[model samples]
Each structure stands twice: as structure tokens, then as C-alpha cells.
Target: MQFQILRDEEGTKADFLDLLENFKPALKEIRTATNQESINEFIVKQVPYTLSAGELESIWK
Candidate 1:
């Protein structure tokens, strides 16, 4: 996954460090749940999402 960080010039490092600290717990939770069967189950339980045939065709083209 990719992320873009937008911030003011002032105190960027402190802001980034704080963001990293806050994300640690979420990362740990994801790490603990890192298994293929669990991931497949999660995807199955999620509401199915789709695009129109026109949209898919546009992407393929």
C-alpha cells in the first residue's frame, strides 16, 4: 500500500513520529492476524464490491 503525507513545514518530524506511534498498535493487530485463511474469511465476509462492465472494459482497454 502507498500513502502520501501532507504537512506544514513546521514540526513535520514530530508530527510523523506521533503518527507512527499511533499506527503501531494497528500494525501489531494486523501482524497478529496475518494468516491466509483469516484473510480469505475476511474478504468473504466483506460486502461484495463491483464495477460496471463498462468500467471494467475501460480499465482493460
Candidate 2:
């Protein structure tokens, strides 16, 4: 299974991190700037993400 997660760094960083933490085990692959840059792993670490960009925008509002 593949998943593309869109996170609003300024607003939903917590939500994003929570998702990663909660689903880390089920997440077969993990890629980030630090991981990719330091290790050059994964074909493409970053993919265009816009599906859930605003899913949590109004959670606090």
C-alpha cells in the first residue's frame, strides 16, 4: 500500500508527526529531507502532496 500525506508545516505539524508516530510500524517506507539527503535513499523522497492539505486547517479554528 502507498500513501501520500500532505502536512501544513505551520499549522498541522503536530498532526503530521502524530500520524507518523502512530503509523510508523505500518508505514513500510519513511522518507524525509534529512533521511534522503544524508543517506540518499529512496528513489524520490518527496512527492507533490495536496489531497489533505486543508483537512486540519480548521481543526483549531
For TM-score, the strongest prediction is 1
How would you encode candidate 2's per-residue C-alpha lDDT over 6-32 as one tens digit per residue?
423333444443554554444325445
Q: Which stretch of 10 consecutive residues in model 1 shows the poorest summed lDDT?
A: 1-10
Q: Quote the positional error of residue 36 for candidate 1 in Å.
A: 16
What TM-score do all the candidates reach, one by one? Answer: 0.31, 0.26
lDDT of 1 at 39: 39
Candidate 1 per-residue lDDT over residues 1-61, each given as its tens digit = 1113422334343343444455555544654334534633442343133334443223212
Collision pairs in model 2: none
Shift of residue 57 alpha carbon in model 2, Å: 26
| Ten residues in sequence with the least summed lDDT for candidate 2 | 52-61
Candidate 2 wrongly placed segments (more than 4 Å): 1-11, 28-61
List RMSD in Å for every model shown.
13.8, 11.0
